[model samples]
Target: MTRHMPISETQDAPPRRRITLPLAPPLEQRRLQLYIALLLLDGAAILNGFCIASWLYLGRFLDETSLLHSQVMLPIYWSIALSLQVYTLTALRRPNFARARAGLSLIGAETVLLFVGFATKSTDNFSRVSSLLGLGLSLVLLMWVRALVRPLIKARCGDAVTNTLLIDDGGTPLRIPHAYHIDAREHHLAPDLSDPHMMDRLGLYMMNMDRVMVSCPHDRRAAWALVFKSANVSGEIVDPEVNMLGVLGARRERGYGALIVASGPLGLRARAVKRLLDLALAGGAVLALGPVLLLVAVLIKLEDGGPVLFIQKRTGRGNRFFPIFKFRSMRVERLDSTGSRSASKDDDRITRIGRFIRSTSIDELPQLFNVLRGEMSIVGPRPHAIGSLAGEKLFWEVDHRYWLRHSLKPGLTGLAQVRGLRGATDTETDLANRLQADLEYLDGWTIWRDLKIIVNTARVLVHDRAF
Candidate 1:
């Protein structure tokens, strides 16, 4: 006969192990479906933009001599349209009302594209009025389609739960429903007692299970102690109250583990897809913008007799060092001696051309190489300088959890930048808020999320939110 050992030598006999917890299903499949849906919708928006642009510019097609008739103009218009669409999508991912934000972002994107086209002399082949009308119509149609599709998409992909274990004061087993249909099994284990041996066993069990939850009553000192020890044993312990804010949605309930189950990690496949996307987008952007980059480099040199490209050491994943590149935006004299100064809107150190590129984020184009070099991602938390503090406070003075943002690779643009958290960090509160957004993005990394940040970064840039 098989024998099970008691948790402690002091115990008279081994406690009865009456029940085996059910395994919760994995959520990877469900997350992937949502990602695929978002991609399809985004692709549709791009196609819609192109078709509308083409229809409006068809008058130029009738005249072979028109500039819009040139094959190059077609691709240029398409690229602009796609960029605009991406910008709008990114803005929509944040806190704004979805429909209104999408409309505003689309309009803003189109307006910028029009100006860029005109500046590049590409509009000579297409009628300006026709392009404007096409842009307006496309924006309206795309907004309507998004409104119609968002709920359906959310229904299909949102509210997915992975298997997690919740330990409650009563030590009863509970099952949390899966967010989406998945085949992987999950398990939940809660102990009825607070013995150190039991807690240790639970901790070991959690490490083996991949995910676990522990709940305690209002008088949770003992439970907290157990969890603290468990946390040391394994890094997977989650506070039921703090982390379940969104999931429970203000619902009150008794018993800690009532709503918890253990399932393996979800969204691994989605993460892989996002990495692949970063590689492709970064590679393509570097290739496509080579000429424009050269022109900008020349302009930077002409504007000031300094190095065309500015390189600085920035902190990235794990607080490692990497050289970040940007077109020189400040007079060489005022480059921060401490490398920790933040730029203000009216900072006098900015050069003439520097203000323009900084406002337009053209100054940041050189960092695309950083993305190619794998030192950064196309989207993530914006990196800060090593030894930088939140305002006058030292780095160690702030919450220790603040450094958790460095857990992921830094990005050229990120959730904080898109949300108007870029530019100067005037106070600790500013840095804290930015760090909060960064951590949120890290916790919820996904392909759609990255795309959303990219799109929003463009919109925010055109609007001059940083300045």
Candidate 2:
């Protein structure tokens, strides 16, 4: 809700400079501690709610058979809890009004329970009164859990105040009661715009801040926002003339000041929905493709008697490394894990079956496992190997902004791939164009777009670049 914004934007800046901000340890630790405490209490509440509901559900017959059912339902219930984000929703930093909305969240839990019960065929087995009673108890216990944890959260974090950075141009300062405001217009905080040393110090100072408010002119807000978001901080333009109705989020509230998420492709709820869909679809695909997978394995093994699966480390979400699996296409000796060079159309290292599999994209079937493991997505930007290059330079070296593509998980097929940007990016322009499409995908990410990309990828399987 309360995001950071850059305070200053040197309008007539001579050159762009990079700023490195170190994270604040004390604040980060306190935040993590509160989150852990909230999670533990939520677990406790769910357990207590389950016990109370079991008593009413089973009535006079509390036997071991019912216990088995309960065991079966435990994970489902846990997942229901997670999907509703019960723990996170009840965070004490949120106002009491927000905390009270836990009841509304239960609606989501109830909806999940209905589908899960039907999927597991427990709807017939479980009593109606029991289910209703249990859900009611959960609602109560969730509130009680927050009530118990609220003091602990407040005691450690101290009234939910933010370390705010205010960049006003010697005008009226923000009068936010809970914010520890640091006005950047002062020389001590934000020094000469051209000084590299000052920039480094400013970066470090901003890390200690929770929010950055730039008191700039209305039209310049967009430019200031980019600068702040580039630094991976929440950016707000403190413009009195700018109307929030149009620019701010539809769900934006009348808080102390206007704040919106910066650099996010989608809202929190949308991301959750996307993640759930990925898990469900990826799981189903793995199950349905079992026979095809086995046949591919056999074909790969019979070709050269080497490893049937190719396991290579590739860049993943947040630039993290994860092993990607594919039906081994090339011979063991010729595998290019680093992606140092592009695979030529008639590369000799590729086996006969490998060529067929790669052409048909059967080689990429193993990546459903990565999707299942949550390291990759059903659709997004395609991750390259760490040593992947656009001609002479590494992909990242071609454009420093390329790292932004890693914000979301790498996909089995991506926006770029569907748009015909797959295969080797042989030039800087090639890589830049792919990055542009990838960034656009990130900016306007939606579940439907993922589905379309997947469909498009399927259509392009027999293309010339598949080799």
Candidate 3:
């Protein structure tokens, strides 16, 4: 033990420092696992519920022998269906088109499963008709449940990280002056730093930074260039046109943030596509639902005497005034007394037939013509009454970004309508939530998303969810 060891270069070197990187918090890791596990378990449970309900309903019509066979095979069918649902949930985390594709793929996979089961000469175990019914019901219920839960779960998980930096030379901070939380977090860097290189560095740094706020005047061409450069490098820029100066100097310098510069509007292609879809789908819908339209028109006229259509001035794209169309659902006398007003459930203004039509959303059928006329889209931010601008005045007055809603044609039914945001806006919170949903739809629009909204609209209408 006393023998002196010769110093070798490797052995004599200072003990190698062990760099222990910080692991994610154990609680956080456990939370993530628990959330994922819950989702999977929910999917499995929902699938099982559908299968059991289907079996119970179909069992009543079958012989005891068939019932016994179904009881054995039902669990197998549910297991397969649950697996497909899990696959769909994983795929929806990407893009809207991907989500739609995932939904269709799930349907296809279920169909294949059915065929496989049939080909195996296991037909006696489950009635072919009942199996097909179960499959259809399961797909609709599961897909809808996924859609409803996905956004909620994502919100709960804090998926959105919107910290924008507005860079502007304008003396005022770009903001909705009266609104609280107008700018989440604002900072002014240095007003005198006009050098393009300085802006570029700042922009790049802001992009690299997590959440930053920057504001510059609309006329500050240098700021635009810097923002554009930052957008190119970081690819996380959210340009919300605001009017605030000095606020641009305080822009944040790090992660997951957007640099909002005063630039001319972007996303012209999306606007154009929205218009084209509005026109085409509206025309097609008008043509397809022509007979139903005629019937509704006749019923409205017969119910209220005379005018079968009600027209009112509403805000359209870019805050422009447009006359909106609807089947006359209110008595002319009541309307005249109350002036233009939002119809409430059991509103004294609504005629008996009007109530029925409004409940069924047939009253909105005439707006299809508005889509064809290029004043509206089949799906978009629902137009609001020009006169009903109560709490929205701050948004209308100080926030130019609110005008962004008008960049596309208003819709017959939109992200708001299908998500229980259709009712009367009695409070500021309601308006904010509705507008947020609208903005989300505008930020992320795809043909598939439109189709999903359209499908959801049809479902709501059929079920009399709208009033």
Each prediction's total of clashing residue pairs, residues at least 3 apart in sequence or on different chains, is: 19, 5, 33
* Candidate 2 stretches greater than 4 Å from native: 1-91, 94-146, 149-261
lDDT for each residue of candidate 1 in 196-292, tens digit (9 for 90 to 100) = 2333334344322223444344454344333432232212222445335645522234433123221211235554675687789988998999998
Query: For residues 64-87, could you state the per-residue lDDT of candidate 2 as single tens digits?
Result: 433444455455645655555544
Q: Rank the candidates by lDDT, best first.
A: 2, 1, 3
TM accuracy, model 3: 0.43
Write model 3 residue lDDT over 179-283, tens digit each, in one string: 111121222234223232333234333332223333344455453343442232222233343123323622332222234442222343455666677777878
What ranges in model 1 sit over 4 Å off? 1-271, 463-467
Give RMSD to native, each candidate: 18.3, 11.1, 22.2
Against the true structure, whose TM-score is highest? 2
Candidate 3, residue 239: Cα displacement in angstroms equals 16
What value does the lDDT take at residue 278 in candidate 2? 87
The lDDT of each candidate is 0.56, 0.66, 0.54
On lDDT, who's better, 2 or 3?
A: 2
